[model samples]
Target: MNQLKKPVIVAFTIITCLFSFSSCKKDSNNNSVDTDDPASADPTLTLVWSDEFNGSTIDTTKWNFEVNGDGGGNGEAQYYTARSTNAAIKDGKLVITARKENYSGKSYTSARLTTQNKAAYTYGRVEARIQLPTGRGMWPAFWMLSAKTPLEWPHDGEIDIMEAVGYRPDTTFSNIHCTAVGYGDLLPVPDYGRTYHVYATDWTADSLKFYVDDRLIVSYANAHLADATAAYNQWPFNHNFFMILNVAVGGAWGGINGIDDTIFPQAMSVDWVRVYQRK
Candidate 1:
């Protein structure tokens, strides 16, 4: 998710480049990198953190529920709440539900969970298994944002590992936002609303790779890393970033076709979240 606004709908174009294996380089590298290659499982990576969602309740020690009705800066219709009815652990999965209700001056209610102050990472492999919600109004996402206080969006950077709007049930989007530029791509993902699939991102100082069911879909290499005139706005992903999971309703992108009020009580079920770092 882009912080200030939803991503611009444009032709899907993957910004790709090559970098040295020894250091982060710019697009000038001579080696031709294939962005479509499946990122191989690294044996050196060890699972350093994980949430199996096996508990009876949301683990407050690792997550914080954001309560607000600020429209998520996207003209969203749902009011985020911290109630168990909005988010709960059931059947070994963290279920985030969006329901039709008049609450806090909003016509819909939902949940937004974050690992803001609880857990953050600089660079690693983060992944989650989730079964999404269907219908015309649902907007479910697994994303990350800078952990810096007094957040400054776009400049601080955002990584949208997975985003699926209810109307586009067979397509999922992956994007990265920065002050320099924002790039996104769409991929075909069948039965995403009814079946579980793994959404993952491998992040490093040099690049970001997005995967669905272990198949690489989008790969972005840092374009300003080796440039002498580059500024922080070109790449602000070096610092710590925390995770966010939410189900938004009638947002800028999700509400483009208007919402289907009949599909209330939609839920996004997250089976597990795991983070890995090189050991």
Candidate 2:
């Protein structure tokens, strides 16, 4: 979540609040019921935007290729490139390949794609079906960051819908990073590298829920808002955020356990990415 270093500590403080009887509406039986409860009336979801990767080439209008060799502030070994070899659409899937080679003074080459200025959303349900690559040093992630100008890391906020380090091929992580706190949750997907899974997050003003294959794994609420000391740093999800998909090579968490050079060519194949909003 730190972007520079994955936090080693997993500390989460969950605060629960009781529903106020005064806010409840009376039912036919004179029973108090919260009509505004999300469970009582779930909104219908409408597909607002999506990319099935059915085209022959990457859709430049929707995605931007980020080319950099800055290590992503985490000592990553790969240089992100815009070349087709690093990122391309094939067989109805978006393939992001990481290759071990001598390129631009780096030992690895990978791709990073984002929907920054081209598209951004405030709150909704975002999901992606992806098949990950395995072997140590590989780090694949589908995440989001604030789209606000003059980007601020950890301050503007970050949401990691799915992150898998090759060392732990069976486990995937979801996390939220803000100035107030950074917490993460993990889910085990057997044979993750060989299978495809839907990683998603339902974000609203009240909470953020993460899921794998539609199974809920993590639920983070805006509990800090009730505290008098809380500020924008505690909850910065009110603004627009852009999505990012990438496979980072050996940096921080992914590189903690040394990389296995034998696995030279690894790739993350994305089947589709869809965004839905309550209609």
Candidate 3:
């Protein structure tokens, strides 16, 4: 009887020690959740495409320069050029500079880069980390347009993930343009123009959600635009769309106040552009 009792006691002690160790490890792991990285927190997102701008030169295969001084139909002051002076890559960043100079019948020069026919996506998450420029006339935008061959402005649809007028340094705009403009709430962040921020849009069949640093700032649901016919004019986002990045000087909205010559040579730098989809 004594031998049996000793063996039983030893087994019970070993089991207790194992349980305590496992519980402590579990508690420690639970308390150490990382919150700084958005990807780690979001388990469903899978990276589909990305341009880190890691090289010293822009990848021609991914982006094409829209070489024109058409003012982008906004009566903008800058002449969009394909020169490296207006757009260049350095230190893993794509810089779009708006310079004050006489060029091609325009008073200023800038660059407009697009992934129009080169690349397009139906729906997913698209985002960019950008540092904006400042001045009275500076207009920087990160947006998307429909890939329709015969594109009609404000009719095919436009998704503005981010837009900022130089005069308003602390405000950011996100909007959708179709038959009518559907604007999002103005986001006021501290030192917005001077600091880098992540602007993103999660697009799906039913809704489009805009985010800043993974925080949802605005959302537009198809239900709001739903009508009897469900025409393409109202819900044109169902088709594939491409991305565009540009810095316009003194446009219809950006130049509402006026152009500031002192802010010439202003630049908007993009750290990276990423696309993702649900796993």
Candidate with maximal lDDT? 1
Residue-level lDDT of model 3, residues 196-265, one tens digit each, is: 7888999998888988877787887786444634556567788888999999888777887999898779
lDDT of 2: 0.81
- Measured with C-alpha atoms, the lDDT of residue 66 in candidate 2 is 89
For each of the candidates, the C-alpha root-mean-square deviation to the true structure, in angstroms, is: 9.9, 11.1, 18.6
Each candidate structure's TM-score, on Cα atoms with residue i matched to residue i, is 0.87, 0.86, 0.84
Score residue 237 of candidate 3 by CA lDDT.
87
For model 1, the stretches where C-alpha displacement exceeds 4 angstroms are 8-42, 224-231
Output the number of the TM-score-best candidate.
Answer: 1
Residue 19 lDDT (model 3): 42
| Rank order (by TM-score, best first) | 1, 2, 3
Worst 10 residues of 1 by lDDT: 22-31
Q: List the residue pairs that clash in candidate 2.
A: none
lDDT of 2 at 91: 86
